[model samples]
Target: MIPAASALARAGHEVLVACVPQLVEEFTSAGLKAVAALPDQAECWAEITDTGHDQVIKVVVGQRLLARGYPELRKVAAWFEPDLVLRDGMEFCGCLVAEQLGIPHVAAPSGAVNTLAPAAIAPLLNERRAEFGLDVQDDPLAIYRYGRIDSLPPRYSFAARGIPRAVAYRQPEASDRCEPLPSWITELDPGKPLVYGAIGVALPTAAASRDGGKASTIPADPVRALAALVGALSELDCTAVVSTGGVSFPRAGVPPHVRLVEHIAQPLLLQTVQLFVTHGGYNSVREAVRAGVPMVVAPLFGDQLDNARKVAELGLGEQATAPSEIAAACRKVLGSSENLARARHAQRELLALPPVDEVARRLALLASAR
Candidate 1:
């Protein structure tokens, strides 16, 4: 969203981000004007680890939080009263406010929208709408009335009925955050394949042990999962770079063949790596596709499973459910000419989409139309 907001700002839009107070600094640091729309108690939703029935609970929790913050958000909307509202898919407060103000609202792609049915969220959204003195919305996708800006290639996108109006746009590489290639990356053996592994930002933290290890509140076991992936990668004859997603693990347990870090510039690293091992988040999938890198997707939850399915269906990569299967999946994708070809094809398709500037211009036009 920072990138999208920055693009709009650069296009000359007077954008003011309405967010939690905690994130005001992040927005201001990115050169965006921001206001705290909600009180400090309205905490953000935690990461979703369970993609089953528990996902509905998570969605309800998010709606309830947005509902609680709606009064403050209404104040922000009335004060800002300029034009259309552009919100990430999960945020319903903006939609509610826009509806109240009789302005258009656009849904920006944050993840696979089709993962959760609109009907699943209608009851909660309507409840919030009633409280706001607005008409109850029967359509769950009402927030996307102005349309959406999609970054995924056609094959990677989900098939859903009643999807809102949308335009395709390419995601720019993270050049701003990228640093020069590190010494370790530069010094890697050219003769050996360079594989990169990341479980993503939402990975559960390490479990506590008798030896005084820290524990996580998240229910998922990402520590064990990450270790499995690293172990499998180490067994192969490849140089592996594994990001632990800020979760600390026993450094002594990491294999000599692997380099573990809390984080790295993935978009930049993808440029040089032969294969990417990812948790199949939409951002990671899009980046790998744009970089023309084949993948081994080990999806943990949510839209990740959908992304993994698409990767396999499109021949862009393979999927592995267990850590022990990651190496073979990587080898299979790397060795397959078809997989590489498909990845390149997807890359070309993504690159052909309109750039961010054009997307920002179109969004501005939407505001003007309203």
Candidate 2:
């Protein structure tokens, strides 16, 4: 997402990124000034690891840190005086700072937030709003102070809550949109049955362990499960495009037909592929739906399970708890007329909507207008 911001900066905008300290170097490399914030990555990690009898302990620590750092955040915002303060939703300080500075701010959600009348955090949100000298409102929907900027369809949240669909944003063919795949995979025979497999971005490399133990050839046991899914695809004579993701495949033992690469550009692959097997991350599901590719999701943790539920409920995809079931699910989707028909219909609906860039532009426009 910072990369997207960098692209915008390249288009002749003055952009100052407010992020934790560790990300400063990477942001600097991309030619943006960085504003380091309180509760840096290490502290956040400590909070994550701070588990014991009292679950509220972490929250207590977080509140203390945030309270201490609010002044620093205000100082930074005053220094930058940005035309628009685009923020990740999780950063409450940014919102407060933006409000205090009387600057137009936009909520660039990293993932889905509670779209309802603030039921998920009504008490907390209300209290925070009061602290910021905002009015209390009965309508939960009115709580969204800054307009939302998201890649997801508005239907994604509205339909989940039984509301009528609002027209969503669309992206035009901007040169800055995700480019075509590198020439190598672009030439693959699009006619063949392509099965694209992926885990997500956050997982550790299978080779690197925290304990510094012998780095196994396969970094994590999850690969074994992923490999099992591949074997199942081979059983059905499907061409498997397995993304090993920085983990080397055993040279002598790889299947003859499966092509193993570290990564295949996802948006491009989705265009030509018949099936997508993925970890059900929000980005993967959104991309697959945007491309209209039916998915077989293997959820690991967090909102992935919820995402998988949405896929299955919408008839856009199927889910597998164990890796062994992936192949059978693939075959089911491939062989069943009902599954194929449902998937195609879902794809058609998704593709007709606008692209993500247009969505961001609309959000920025709406936020600035407010």
Candidate 3:
């Protein structure tokens, strides 16, 4: 999303990123005008599991966040008077705001957000629409009325039917400086393959206990999962790098074959990595695809399962859960030319699409017409 915002700003568009307080600094650091207009949603997502069955579909963002966020968004929109609204795929408030203002808006692709069933989410959003004094929309695709942007080709998309699809455009490498890789990473076992494994920051690593901040809020025990992956990677013949999202790792036994660090330049590292062991976050999957790297996907929850299934379906890699299964998958994937070929094919497709700068140009044309 930072890449998208940055692209628009570079194109001479006046962009204001309205996000929660925690993310304000990061957005401003990117050289964009950012404000803390949205509410803190940690507690909202945590309490969602107890809600009704219909409400469970869009767990992360729903009426609760919408109620708190829409007012803020409307206030900002009234003054900013944006010609077009670009929103995260999971965010519903922008859709409602666009509808109220009778303007255009587009969604950026998200792993699980695009996969949400419109039939399931329509009633939920329409309820809010009616309350806002807007006519209730019957069209399931109203949320994406102007369409959505995607890095993937149309045929390779994970979004369900009726989600207005955007033309395929290359998603940039985010262009942000990632935490530096330890200097010794390139020095290890040059003749053998290099494997990179990372579970996203949303979940807690085994080392999260040492960080002492927000680790308790994570509902699942990702530490055991991380430990299993570390254990498996330790025995593999290849050199391995695992990122623990800035938390201290392995209280004692540190193996030479593997390196556990707080962070690394993921976009750059993916280019050299022979195989990626991932928790199947979409951004990670997208980066691997852009790099033409094969994957061993072990999805923990949510849309990760869907993304993993898409990986397997595309012949890009294998999916596994258990540590032994992951180890087996890694060995098989590393040895397979087919997986590598498919991955490269996806990369070529991504490369063929217009770059994000060009996409920004098209978006500007659309906004001007609006």
What lDDT is obtained when candidate 1 is compared to the true structure?
0.76
Give me candidate 1's TM-score against the actual structure: 0.89
Residue pairs of candidate 3 with colliding backbone atoms: none
Q: When superposed on Cα atoms, how far off is each prediction in RMSD?
A: 3.4, 5.6, 2.7
Error of 3 at 213 (Å): 5.9
Candidate 2, clashing residue pairs?
A: 117-140, 170-354, 171-355, 171-358, 206-219, 207-219
lDDT of 1 at 312: 91
* Candidate 2 residue-wise lDDT, 1-370, digit = tens: 4644754565556777877665788788867778687445333333343222132223322454446556777787776666667776546566656666666666554433322224443455456556656564455443245555555565453122622234344333222346666675655655667788887664434234333463223323555655665666667666667776655456356665567777667777777778888877777776776677888887765456666777777777788777778778888776656655666665566567675555445544654576
Residue runs of model 2 more than 4 Å from their true location after superposition: 1-14, 25-33, 38-71, 102-104, 112-117, 123-143, 156-167, 171-192, 205-228, 231-234, 248-253, 336-370
- lDDT tens per residue, model 3, 153-266: 776677766677676788766534666555787588889999999987667542363355542245445666678778878778999999877644564675877888777888
**Which residue runs does candidate 1 get wrong by more than 4 Å?**
39-49, 53-63, 112-114, 158-162, 204-217
Candidate order (lDDT): 3, 1, 2
For all predicted structures, in order, the TM-scores are 0.89, 0.73, 0.91
lDDT of each: 0.76, 0.60, 0.80
RMSD of 1: 3.4
What is the Å distance of residue 272 in model 1 from its true position? 0.5
Candidate 1 residue 68 Cα shift, in angstroms, is 1.4
